[model samples]
Target chain A: MPVIEVNQLHKRYRDQVAVHDVSFSVEEGEIFGVLGRNGAGKTTTVECIEGLRSPDGGSISVLGLHPARDRAELRRVLGIQLQASELPDKLRVAEAIELYASFYPSPADPRELLERWGLGAKRNTAFGNLSGGQKQRLSIALALVGNPRVAILDELTTGLDPQARRDAWESIEQIRRGGVTVVLVTHFMEEAERLCDRIAVIDAGRVVALDTPAGLVAGLIGGQRLRFRPSIPFEDAVLTQLAEVESVRRSGPHVEVTGGGDLLHAVTSALARHQVVPGDLRLEQATLDDAFVALTGPAAEN
Target chain B: MNETASATRTMARAPQRRAPRPFRALAVAETRLFLRDPVTVLLAIALPSVILAGLGAVPALREPADVFGGIRFVDYFAPSLLAINIAVLGLQNLPTGLATYREKGVLRRLSATPMNPSAVLVVQLVINLVTVAVGTVLMLAVAVYAFDVPAPRHPVGFVLTFLLGTSAVFAIGLVIAAVAPRARIAAGIGTVAFMLTQFFAGVYLPKYLLPEVVVRIGEFVPPGIGAFQGAWTGDGPAPLQLAAMAVIAVVATAVAARFFRWE
Candidate 1:
């Protein structure tokens, strides 16, 4: 059964619809990605699911329990790491961890959690004194302390260094391997592609596309793209003679060849037959970035 | 198989785990934080003591037909200052602290946990009450030993007034904390309210010396006006007035709770 099921979830701030008729289900132990640009209503939708914000319309259930109606029960089994939350400036890291642990009926040992997150060394440091990455790690540690069955993480690596981001990704994968369902909301296409089992692309408060990253790329791009910097300027006759070349387009000095199966070999054979070789030959598989650009019309500046 | 059984045992033991320790932990943490601020500590202790000493030094501050019937100024103002101390902590410190927490997103983070918002509020109140109690005791000690203030004419009346007055002001502070747009606004409101109480409620000045209109206005304001009747003048007003004030406090607390923003 799906650990979290949200159907036709709708929320509005004043007259502006924040989330409009959104729906999705997160199966047990799956890393589900809710990918969207900033202000795409991803956070609002997830917040409603977490019982932090009451939905204006539709129903939400986590582990078959209504999140709003059964908030205490839901909170007990579901952990959340909000994008921007803060602890008191004077509160020490260890104290903050222990305090959050004490809230639950049963919680992971604060020491163990600290050790796991490599935050044990800075346990006595005040929250405000910690670096940005340390604070983010602490937030993640707080979310896991409840040993929740389902964890929701929003903007997991918005402001982390590359190494910290990689570490976080590994930690998330480990969490999923441990049989905990995760709902990851992120704007990073690479992060989503690497971690998510299924990706839901949200745009303007709606899911514009939903599929596996590879599937979405394959389905959206239609065929493979061959990019080459030709040694000699090519004529239409040279391109039309290639057997696998379905279409061709040129911009500046670059040539793009579009076709189906074994298109790369066909292009190479045709180029060799013509005694012409490109200076830079590359076969490009469609990526989620390309798929996002195709579907959303323009890549959102991150 | 052994791991599974041990895990099952742990899960079963989880439900029977001890009650939440966040409140106690937060209280100790908050008290330590409070003490770390030297200015706050000094204000909490010095405000009442200074008032008590200053009032005791001035013998003419007492009126011949004092409301206590024959009570000295020191005897009357001591408990009034005790109420004032509670009011200062509750109305001033608590609201500003809450606003700061909201500004810093501390309360928002806590709300996301299994701990309810009420638990955080309760912890804050507990810390405030403890601090106020200590300040009250110290003030009382100084009043009796150094200042020679008379003992409570009616211990029950004094206790009742202290409890009721603290509740009322704390509720009022909660309202301010909940409704104030920001920390600056809360501080501004708290300062204005404190100054109004000091000037009009006759904390330092005699109420009889004030104009009739001002005295009439003070009749309704808490701590200063209410403390005069409740603590200073034992025969000041009927019991129903105190009851009405308590009701107002309760209503204020309800309204504050209703409008409280955990953000």
Candidate 2:
């Protein structure tokens, strides 16, 4: 059974439809990613599942409990990390952890949790004094202190450095290993590719595509490009005439081939037959970035 | 593997855990934050007595005054300054603090937890109320010890009027916090309200010597109500003044509750 399910969810803010028809389910102990452009209703959809906002025209269930009606019960098992959420500037890190821990009945030990999150040394540090990455780590620790069955993290690593981002990914993997289901809302293609078991790409409040990292990247496989420099001169038609080649272009001494279905083998064999050896050969595999662009159209950036 | 799965299942199926009391955590956190704010501490818990001390040290203010019914001028000024304490905290400090928290998404974040977001508001109200109470105590102590100000003839009446007046001012502050779009705007509105109410409360001029029009208006305003009734005159707020304050308190609190936004 799905741990969290949102079906045909629709939400509007003052006549502006924030989410039109969002539908997906997060299976238990999986890192389900919601990838989208900014203002693409990713946060709004997750907020609905978190019971922060009620959908106008759909039903949501978490552990067989209605989000709106069972908000109190859901809160006990669903941890949330809101985008740009902040604590009081003067609050100490240890105090913050303990205070949030107090809100849960059987909370994890805050001191141990802090140490595990790499924040034990900063326990006495004031929130305002911490760097941006440290603050994000603290926010993550607070979200998990309640021992929630499901954790929803929104824009988890928007402002972190590359190393910090890796640390966060490791922490997320650890959370999943502990049997907590995670619904991660993010726009970073690389983050979704690395951490998500499956990603639902949202654009304009719609789920444009839903697939695993490799599966989504497969959508752009047919358009994969291969480029090489031939040892001997060859006509563009020589490559273009073949069934595997969609189009052929020559820029300087390089011949760029764009197509799918054994194009590399076909090009290499043709080159060998023509007594022309290809040098500086490179085959560019389709990436999640290309697949994301194909799925969501233009102007999608993290 | 089965044992691990069953353990996880049992953990998920167990009864929902909860914090000890509803808003105790929020209240405790907010109280810690309040103690760390130096400006609020000085303004709400220290400034009232300082102002009173300044007024008392003036030799001219120590003279017997017919306007005060043979009492020294400084003795009559004590309660007026106490009103200023409530206005400074309730109008200036409380509104800005709450509005900033709302602007920073603090309240919205709290809503995600099991605790009600309004718990933060309650915490603010409690903290500010305590500050006002402390300031009043210090001001009264200074008035009695340093300035030789007489105790109120109608102590019970003074206490009741003071409580009503504080609630009325805090209600107006809450309305300002609810309506202001940002912390800066809230602080601005609070400052204007504080200054205007201070003027009416006769902070700048003696209530007995004010112009008839000013005194009549002051009769309806906060601390001003206390002043017009004679802070030391021992008489409580007049029936009309008391009724107006109660009305303002109820109406403003209702409006605040209706319009307050978490973010």
TM-score top scorer: 2
Q: Write the per-residue lDDT of candidate 1 for residues B1-263, one digit (tens) a residue.
A: 99799768866766566645766766777777777677887787678888778777776755444564576666655554665677678878999989988887788777778777677678788888877778877887788788666555556665676666667778889999999989889998988777676665667566546788887666556653454355534654446546755886899999998999988
Tens digits of per-residue lDDT for model 2 on B1-263?
A: 99799757756654454445546776888888888888879877888799889878899999998888787888777667777889989998999999999888888888888777887888899899988988888887888888888777667767777888889999999999999999999999999999988888878777786888987887788654553355356565576777788888999999999999998
Off by over 4 Å in 2: A221-223, A228-280, A300-302, B1-22, B227-231
Alpha carbon lDDT of residue A241, candidate 1? Answer: 70
Task: Please give the TM-score for the first chain of candidate 2.
Answer: 0.90
Clashing pairs in 2: none
| DockQ for all models | 0.52, 0.44
RMSD of each: 4.3, 4.4
Model 1 Cα lDDT, one tens digit per residue, A152-248: 9998887788988998899999989989999999989999999999988888888888888887876664367988888876575676676666788
| Candidate with best DockQ | 1
Fnat by candidate, in order: 0.61, 0.66
lDDT tens digits by residue: candidate 2, A1-302: 99988899999999899999989888989999999989999999998999888889988999999988998989889899998888888999999988888777778777767987789999999999999888988998889988899999999987788988898899899989999999999989889999999999999999999989887876564557888889989887778888888888889989888877678999899888888899999998778889888887888354
- Candidate 2, after superposition: displacement of residue B125 in Å? 0.5
- Measured against the true structure, the TM-scores of the candidates, in listed sequence, are 0.87, 0.90
